[model samples]
Target: MTQSLSPLKSFSPDSGQVKVWIRRLVWKMSIATFLLMAIGSATRVMNAGLACPDWPLCYGQFVPTQQMNLQVFLEWFHRLDAALIGMSAIALVGLSVWFRNVLPRWLPWASGFALFLIVFQGILGGLTVTELLRFDIVTAHLGTALFFFVTLLTIGACLSDFQGNNTANKLPWIGLTAASLIYLQSLLGGLVASQWALHQCFFRGDMCIVMNTHIIGVVPAALATLAAIVISWRTAALHPLIRTFANIALVLISSQILIGVATFKLHLQVAPLTVTHQAVGAALLGSLTLLTVFALRDRQSSGQYPASKLT
Candidate 1:
């Protein structure tokens, strides 16, 4: 005899409480992911990428001692943060698996993918130090972290209980388009950073080489954002979430463009603005990705299958 599938269980009012707990866990993971990115960025900005001159440890020690220098400390701290975040990711995967029957398959799978990406990211981090920050490895490191951040955001959104009730499905294509462009732009930004081309446009004054290359990627990104906005605005009467995310995309893209210009015009290669610009780019990319995931998810929750899968 064939095994019978389990019957669907009746909805529990306490499901809301469970969802809230999941949302909290997702937020914690998101924060951890963001902190990892910040620490990585800080290490780069501080010129401490090669401080340890080793992989998975600092100066051949699991923990540096008081005799260790500041560079060693920075590098060790970064590793510590990475380890914490990795543990957090493992916890997320465990929770997802435990709740597999209650939660959507997408939730656990997405969390697992993020966990895998974190491991890949850790390897890339080691390679970055081992190769003395080779351009290719560094670029890959940043890009991988960006991917991880986006994955975390997706899981976070999935955990939220805010399922839209609008049966009307529209602009799924636009959301996907926006996500693709944002991801491309994020990769290009990583390339710029990895190449240390931030100063490429310094001498030109009128023409910005680094900014131009970055701007080239932005063209498609902006077009995608615009398309999403137009589509969402037209369908706003049907889905308010669409409208909200559309406006958010417009605002974030505009701010990102401004930050890019400011970073170039001011010749900002260090300190607050440089870090701020980097953070803003990360935020913009993460936000766009989240919007796209949630948009598709809203459709899915409403029993309208999205045109594409996130994976």
Candidate 2:
């Protein structure tokens, strides 16, 4: 987000300053969440989800230096990242509420909802261990993290300064649809990983349904994302910003497909490729989301959509 939300411009300079600070925190947390998801993926693939064997601690100690190894370190660092963000969420909410008089009224509520997701995500993370990495719980953990990531992006986009042209009509909705499909595809991908569906289908001829579902899922998500890029590129006078994000989404989804193919060919044995698959999926989703929010903001600010739609 390059600028403070337009409505907040009416407030005093101090309020603008406050918005800037909160926006920075949202961005920082967003980056951390992205890395946290990557680390979580690594933990799962490395069989480190259960390395701690306890909630919020490893072997009843904060550091667990004596037990620290690669698996333990992955799992431990993952939790540390989550815990830091959990606390930072509290501060985010506090700032939103404390500055509500001048900031957008919805900021505090949005922050609250994000905090709720993080709390639920924390619980799901615990269940992944106590439930012994049950496929369902693990899938939910990844899903919630993606959901939280989207929320942060939405908030950040709303606070951003945006510029758009007449060609933006319907692009926001298009990007949103693509983003939704991509999110579902990502969850499907998560399921495939959590259940070891690919490995099962390849070796034991089991869990083929899950693996196939993920394979079939690539169609809608890829088509929708490609549609956005094609429409943006073909449109005359579309904002460069939207074009840039669409291009990024295209690269990410394309890379994801290639990486998915490579990972399948390798049967998930290549840890780097497997991890990149998930990370790129997250990045693709983020690109689509930011594109949608920017379009929404652009239209709303330009009077095509009601202010309530975005600001």
Candidate 3:
């Protein structure tokens, strides 16, 4: 039998209860999406992206019993996780519509857009295999996955208990800048991984530019992240969550930098380290997103965005 939500035993039909339920559901999906990305990264690092050699199936079957191995398992399970998350996204939209009166008007629309991103992500995922894991296709696949992850986080934050304040009007913008820079850096890193840039640059002395660009991109991203943390620390009476997020971002970025350096030094030969680098990067981005979205809500509730108000 299919399991219900964790809190279903005590679930109430009230609108407040529904809001909490949906918010918790979104956060759970967000965590699942995060793991899916990590699994995708592991698939790439393990050179298992094309293990099945088909879309939506392994060896043209639901499960390739004869071909099951580490590589096939990674690819197959990656698709499985993606499929489940896609289904959850559909449920999210359905629940938003089913409870439209009680839920925020934008929840349905935002969930729908997230579904759109996941659809696009699925297309990219297929292209990665059909097109022989071309660097651009692979990079776009990672980028779309990250975007979908961000969409979920945004939804969860909007439904969160985070309250707004007037103490820091500019923190939101700063957080956005940092988040955007980090996202671009991630795409660049994806390219570097997809093309095997580090290995090429280290051994064959080719593709140095791609690897170098990723290394150089870190400077701006790190500086922006640090700026957000410093500014948030100085903002008096900032929402406790805001400060917590900023601090988490700082720690994540620091860990990401160290992981990146280690991955590079090891020439990307260490699959676990390589995967950890990507996972840490995702976590860092998530932290920045939480900070930015909460800060944006603060600005909105404080009447900073008069024309475009959030519910």
Candidate 4:
């Protein structure tokens, strides 16, 4: 069937409309990246990290014909999601370039860096499988994924025009501290799981050192998160989104701790709980990123960074 096209409905949107759409796209991609981390976590928890036994393919074919088992499907879908994230990064970069006049000067460079991370993430995924999920490599893989997730969040925040810089805002450094603690704790937890330390806790007490350290590290992490929440609340009048993000971070961390307890009690054998733990970790990371965006400003042209300069 042929239909006549109407030029009346084809008018281009103004810069403001384009900006809104670009911001929305970046935000959606950021969230999708977060979910992708969760899926990747589930794949690993299900012992499917090597289900494909190859990079960018399954069973030496585009699709696994020998058997479409659960493990194979998880790994296949994980790779598929990674491909989608890569595509989104490309789109984000393209949008940044096309809308350079509206976006911050650093946005294109930042998006380009995110694309680099996607490529590096792919390499890490390949190594995780080829090297039989070595503890260090597996931990590195998780770290890289988290970093990429943070990068996307940062980009989305940069594109956002909703947050205003508040001269009254204080305690900005607290967010960075909390984020660092969360990242370190997550890395240690990943290392313990990848090395099978949690599984050996009952018998190989000596191998439980990393797990024990991770548990102990929770105290400081929780305190830092709490501090962030309190600071955000106090500064809410000046910066509302910061308070909202801090509250979300608190909730995620609380859920994460509960899940950690359950995962420990169950000896990390429960796949769902394990995945939930990792997913919460990603959410917490995203929240901390919001806090960072709330706290820091863009670098000034004079090379002097000021708290108010970001907005």
Error of 4 at 37 (Å): 1.3
**Candidate 1: residue pairs that collide:** none
Residue 45 lDDT in candidate 4: 82
Deviation in Å, model 3, residue 15 alpha carbon: 2.2
Which 10-residue window of candidate 2 scores lowest in summed lDDT?
Answer: 302-311
Q: lDDT per model, in order?
A: 0.72, 0.89, 0.89, 0.79
lDDT of 2: 0.89
lDDT tens digits, residue span 1-311, model 3: 23666577555487777788788888888989999999999999888998999887789999899999999999999999999999999999999999889989999999999999998999999888999999999999999999999999999888876556666679999999999999999999999989988888888999999999999999999999999999999997677778888999989999999988888888888889999999999999999998999888877665222221222
Q: Would you list the clashing residue pairs of candidate 4?
A: 297-310, 298-310
Clashing pairs in 3: none
How far residue 191's Cα lies from its native spot in candidate 2, in Å, is 0.7
Give the better candidate number (3 or 4) by TM-score: 3
Query: Candidate 2's residue-wise lDDT over 99-215, tens digit each?
Result: 899899899999999999999999999899999999999999999999999999899878765656556778888999999999999999999999999988988999999999999
Judged by TM-score relative to the true structure, which candidate is superior, 1 or 2? 2
Candidate 1 ranges with C-alpha deviation above 4 Å: 1-18, 65-73, 200-211, 238-242, 301-311
Worst 10 residues of 4 by lDDT: 298-307
Measured with C-alpha atoms, the lDDT of residue 77 in candidate 4 is 84
Preferred candidate (lDDT higher): 2 or 4 = 2
lDDT of 3 at 81: 91
